[model samples]
Target: MDPLLILMLLAMGAFGGFAAGLLGIGGGMILVPFITMVLTARGVPETLVVHMAIATSLATIMFTSLSSVRAHHRHGAVLWRVVQLLAPGIVAGSMIGPWIGKQMDASTLAWFFGAFVAFSATQMLVNKKPAAARDLPGTGGMFAAGGLIGTLAGLVGAGGGFVSVPFMTWCGVRIHHAVATSAALGFPIALAGTVANVFYGWGEPGLPDYSLGFVYMPALLIIVAASVATAPLGARTAHKMPVRRLQKVFAVILYALAAYMFWRAA
Candidate 1:
């Protein structure tokens, strides 16, 4: 890789890691589009660029999630019981999601991602609260929700926070606790998604050199090194900051990214 490209990857990792920790996201939302652009600029085939970007983004999240989750765990905010309940379905859904994505045209996937990002941004901007408070659901409900979250996360290379956080808050969990638990959920989502991507893309033509299945190894390594170091810092900041305001700012950013994705798809 060029030295400049390496620098760009490092910068992206720093930003993504901070965002992941601060928002309880897996950072894939931030990473995917940027990585796609980089790969395209590097002459990677357009057919494979988006898939590689999504897979590499998920792979990087594996490290970022661990770093962020550790910080949340230290603060006693992670709901371990919830994680245990949701993880099985999350794993299953994530494993299946990449296969579904692989069947879609790249342009179609880009459009879907743009729409999903826009919807998530709108939800954050609205910040709607549930009309009535309710407790967490039973095992079956939780499993179903987890399946939905994992599937979407895998399809778009997100950390599932855009769905999970709101869902938990609606169930009467505190926002901070919801965020912390969402961070914990990211690990399974990313792990399963990455593994599935590898199998699904193996032996596919048009993939660039230094790729493991769909994942671009150089970018993943560079991003993970920086993201892991900075994620804890973001987690610490999240505890101290006013999260609602931050979420609004993040939503605005998402909206801009969504527009960019739409333009790229066009």
Candidate 2:
């Protein structure tokens, strides 16, 4: 709620949003950690700040995803078939992640998050195997991928793109299309994750003010506004650069954040 913090968040949003759009990352990976700093600085109960940040970032992704997906769609990169195939699974898995997140301590969540982020980064650097492209399985495979992405999403409060993008790319979807379709998945991931987070934190004792469910609205609004404005810029830039380098760079940043989260969690 402090004026200075609001400005800082918006500024961070603009920068992170641009990178997210260009990279097909949901930005929550970065935003949640940044927000954890803010919430903790404001004298919030330390135990709850990380949870609130993750939950709130997931909520914001629902809105940011629409804009990023549109940009990717215009590039003719989004494969609707893929999004349709994976969505149902995402919804089912997301419904339960937040509840489980609530049951654990923030430190445990941070460790889980850090490890996951590091793993995703390594996958990016190594260019992991691709998935079946449009050759979606009848029922079992779809359910499996969706379940995995969704459950992790709920547990981590992510947009699920970290897993979804590579999986699709390996499956035979082109990189651009994989990223675009993964962007589309953010909406459902965020929505379902948001609902569960709210319920998870609803009436338990000891929470910060200006929270809706587990989200801090002030940070949410600033992040959404700035991310929306800059995502298109990132989308346009994504094509202009050597994506291999970009992936590595992003991976380093992820590692850096992962380290920071680990330290903080400790």
Q: Return the TM-score for each candidate structure.
A: 0.97, 0.93
Per-residue alpha-carbon lDDT of model 2 for 55-84, expressed as tens digits? 988888887888888888788888887777
Q: How big is the positional error of residue 71 in model 2, measured in Å on the Cα after superposition?
A: 0.8
Candidate 1 local Cα displacement, residue 89, angstroms:
0.6
Alpha-carbon shift of residue 266 in model 2 (angstroms): 1.4
Candidate 1 clash pair list: none
Q: Compute the lDDT for candidate 2.
A: 0.82
List, residue by residue over 1-266, the lDDT tens digit for candidate 1: 89999999999999899989998888888888889889988999888888888899999989999999999999999999999998988998898788888998888888888898899888878988554368889999999999999999999998999889888988888888998999999999999999999999998998888999998999999999999999998899999977788889878988988887888788
Clashing residue pairs in candidate 2 (N, C-alpha, C atoms within 3 angstroms) = 130-170, 130-171, 131-170, 131-171, 132-171, 133-171, 133-172
Residues forming the 10-long window of minimal summed lDDT in candidate 1: 127-136
What's the C-alpha lDDT at position 207 in model 2?
Answer: 76
Displacement of residue 20 (Cα, Å) in model 2 is: 2.4
